[model samples]
Target chain A: MTPMTLADAANLHTFVDALRFIGDHPGFLAQKALEQLELSGAALGIAIAVALPLGVVLGHFHRGSGVAIGASIVGRALPSLVLIAAFLTLLGIGFVNNMVALAVLGSGPILTNSYDGVDRVDNEIAESARGMGMTGWQIVRRIELPLAIPLLFTGIRIAAVTIVATAPIAAIAGGGGLGDVIVNQASYRLSGVLGASLCVMALSALVFVALAGIQIGVTPRGLRGTTVVHDHSRKEQQ
Target chain B: MQSHWGDTLQPALVQHIELTAIAVVLGFAIAFPLALLAHRYRKLEHPIGVFSALLYTIPSLALFQLLIPFTGLTWTTVEVALVAYTLVILFPNIVAGLHSAPDEVLEAARGMGLTRMQTLTQVELPLAIPAIVGGLRVAVVSTVAIATIAAFLLPDGLGYPIVLALKEPTPFKTEIYSAGALAISFALLCDLALVALRRALAPWAARGLA
Candidate 1:
């Protein structure tokens, strides 16, 4: 008991015990990671699906970027924990509620980035495409979407980072992940909590690094510099 | 009015705001100078940015849990973590905002015989208000959200109701509603007020939201 207590302390012993915990409960950590990935990946996928086209169209015509901007402001203000709990009372503690919260949160970045990306495309290119008798959709698909791809990916990266960081909180609503190990300190024991937290942190880091690699890989070499700077603005929302 | 366990709403809302305001003000105070230094000495950017990012990357729960051994579930633990989260956002925004002033505008100020410090205070800072205000809004909103988790540590602030309702058999409906709604409201109000404040202070940059 004493050694387990020491191991749970979130210190060097916790780190050592974290390794041991993972080794001992490989199945448990793997399942938790799976839950986390599923939620965030689902949330990110839905957010991009909804926000990307909306942002592109709005940005193309320059009509309602305000929606993206305002949503982000409101979204940043709503704490994920509270939102999840609120949804729990309303929707019952389950996957749907947590998924809804993450999607709402993640939509902000994707929409805003898509809007900014499409709006910033070189108008001259679009005009030339227009002069060549291309219609709005064709011009968009051909010129603007290609140009906006990097920014779109930046948005996804931002949303993915936010979702990964936030997904652990889903434990509160029984939308279980590493948060079970984090919040149920008594049940999992402190070493378990600490070890699970290390797992959550590692999961988030892995998501961030992997997505960043994807962002870089997708972006054209010439556009890479702009993409890097573009990422800093995305951080402002977080 | 009592809603189980003799808890009221006013104090929770007030404390949440107070806690959030203090952390943001203190965070801004510390981050500003660091931003200035980082901006002035280009060499400091990566290291400072990395340090802030490292602090920011610590998961909120892990951070609180890590501090329990030393701080013993105190406000100090909450404040330290809250303040640390703001640095990564604030430092970069301040630097970016300060640099937002056009190079020509800065050179003209220098040509006006304005000392470097005076130009920074007088010319550059005013120009930088938009970015600074943007950063402040993000920090305040995020802090409000994070502050709710403080209930687990001290049973204080809006988080108290939130934590209580979620944990105990109290009719959690009101508690969850009040805490969540108030937090969202606080964030929106603070953000809107900052937008107005930015507009009032820096009218020049009002050209299409700067």
Candidate 2:
């Protein structure tokens, strides 16, 4: 399809028309949104399951920091469209292909943040925990994990937003979502495209806000003040 | 198709670079002054930071489409969104870099009768190069990756082939792999170049003493 001129687009459908299109297809839009949420949620679940343990272990042992941080850099640098295309070739079109690709994409931040969060816990604090004769597992579980909640959630927030944003590409691989509307511009036309984009932006914002709330809720009040100290130390380390 | 792969990819590669370059340059052009302004006025810092972060949170695909009604499917639409993406990274880094020059250094510049502009130009900016270039590297690398999506609107980048292959009746493995590989390599290359730039721009920073 040729690109439309502004006048052509405006004449065809204004943003209001996009909203009306959305309103007209409530069930269809809801299904698309749910598909989007399911795919991203599943991918995020897999990523956290895999990355959290690995990152925390590495961080607890103070090992593989490079791998943790490096993975995130590469992950962030990856283009999601290309990722979906590449996966489609490997796995063929379907939900699995997109799910796996999204999982890999989401894992990076979670891994990096998990490791950094644990690794950055004050040495003196960890030492005191050790001095008190707490087991390694106990220290990691009771001390480091709680302290790392904020950064862990930061990682998750980044991953969730990224996954939600990129989930639209899954439609290209026949994994249905809002992308079905956004990418199928020929069938759905510009109104559906704009409407779906609005849905996606809303979904992403919702995910971010939800994660932020979880981060705050999970963060210990006492440690909240100390995060600043951690921030300062991080700057000094840099 | 095999014989013409080079011809097809060359223009796409050029377009990809052109888009990434323009966006990063324009993003920096806009962000640098905003960073300076935020630095000059403490009150502006929170708002500028919050606004940029909010922009960053908006998905690139959505942002592009959101602009299309007004901007059409032109490169301007893509550039505007891409520039917006860069601000979150660029503004914070530039502000942090500007603050990196210590109070002692600022006082030294002042004590030496250096004017505000002279102090900024000669001392602070020079000191800020590491942080500034660090942020620039991230912005460039991300822009390289994100510009591929612009091909959805404009058939002018590596993303074009990937999009084409995906939309094909039978997906084209060759196109998908080639374009994906090229984009990943391009991002890595840009990152390396920026790392080298940071070294050259602030040689002392490479020494790890600073």
Candidate 3:
């Protein structure tokens, strides 16, 4: 199907129609949103569970070992499409498969940020904690983990936004998401595409805000302002 | 269809590469200037950075569809989203890399009577290679990945085979796997090449004693 023209996209009727369509079938759009959210949440949850610990442990050891860097780099660089497509071939089509693919794609940022967050903890802080008879676990639990909250959630936030944004592609695997609306241009046409895009973007924005709130909530209020906004996470988005 | 697998897979790979090149090269071209502008004007960084960051968050699918009205399912449409996706990474890297140049080193260049532009070109830029290249590596890899999805916009990409296979009554597993492998392989190849490029561009980075 050919794409919509500028006129169609700009026509006041388009926005009105799209909004009406969304209003008319709130259930369908809501279901799509929930499905997208579920897949995104599952994908990011798996990624954080796996990559977060690995990153935190590697960071706690203060090891800049090649494994840490190599893993994050490769993880960040691997595209979601490749993972999704590859999994589709191997696993056919399933919710579990889509989650794994997204986990693979999202793991890099989590790993990288977690590692960086822990690795960059002030030596004085760790040493002071150690000097006070803190065990390795104690130091990690008290000093490092608290300090790393900003970065840890930053990683999760990046993963969350990315997963939410990319979950639509799950449609190709027979997984439900807004991606179906975008692809089925025949039925939806311009408004469907535009409306779906709006929904997906809204989902992403909601995910980001919700995660950011968590990041801030966990962070010590004083340190909150200083937790650098990791805007460079664009690499993870596609 | 039993014959000439070369004609098919080869072009798909090349087209992916061409798409990557167009997107990255042009992305860098636009990003570098913007980076410089942001660097020169500190106030610009916040707005420009925020804008790019917001743009960055817009999913590739939405962004591509968002442009269909203007670009209309053409290669240009794909490239627009691809390039926009790149800017968020590229701009920050260029500016940060430039800013990351050690003040003393920059002062030393200035002390040697190099003009501002001369200092930037001769000393700062070389010093900035690692970060800039780091950004480039990410940009290239992600662009390659994003371009796979671009097949939904325009044909003749690795994504084409995957999309096509899905449409088949029984989607051929090998076909999907092979295309996926090639796309992943192409991204890795670009990444490795850029690693080598960074090393070649700034040999001092390896030694770390700079």
Candidate 2's residue-wise lDDT over A1-238, tens digit each? 9787768757566788899988999899989999999999899999999999999999998889679868877986789988888888888888888999999999999999899899878777788999999999999999999989888888999988889988987887887999888878889988899999988888888888788888788788986645623533544564
* Residue pairs with clashing backbones, model 3: none
Best-first order by DockQ = 2, 3, 1
Residues B57-132, model 1: lDDT tens digits: 5678777776665566788889888888887788889998987888889889989899988998998888888899
Q: What is the iRMSD of the candidate numbered 1?
A: 3.4
Interface RMSD of 3: 3.4
True lDDT of residue A82, candidate 1: 83
Q: What DockQ, on C-alphas, does every prediction get? A: 0.43, 0.56, 0.47
Better candidate by TM-score, 2 or 3: 2
Interface quality of candidate 3 as DockQ: 0.47
Per candidate, the number of residue pairs that clash is: 1, 0, 0
RMSD of each: 5.0, 3.8, 5.3
Per TM-score, the best of the predicted structures is 2
Candidate 2 residues lying further than 4 Å off, grouped into runs, are A1-13, A225-238, B206-210
TM-score of each: 0.90, 0.93, 0.90
Task: Give the per-residue lDDT of model 3 (tens digit) for A1-238.
Answer: 8887667656656667677777777788888989888888888888989999899999899676466677766775566776787787677777988988988888888888888888777776788989999999998888888888888788888888888888987787777888889888898888887788888888787777787788778887768789633332342342
lDDT assessment of candidate 2: 0.86
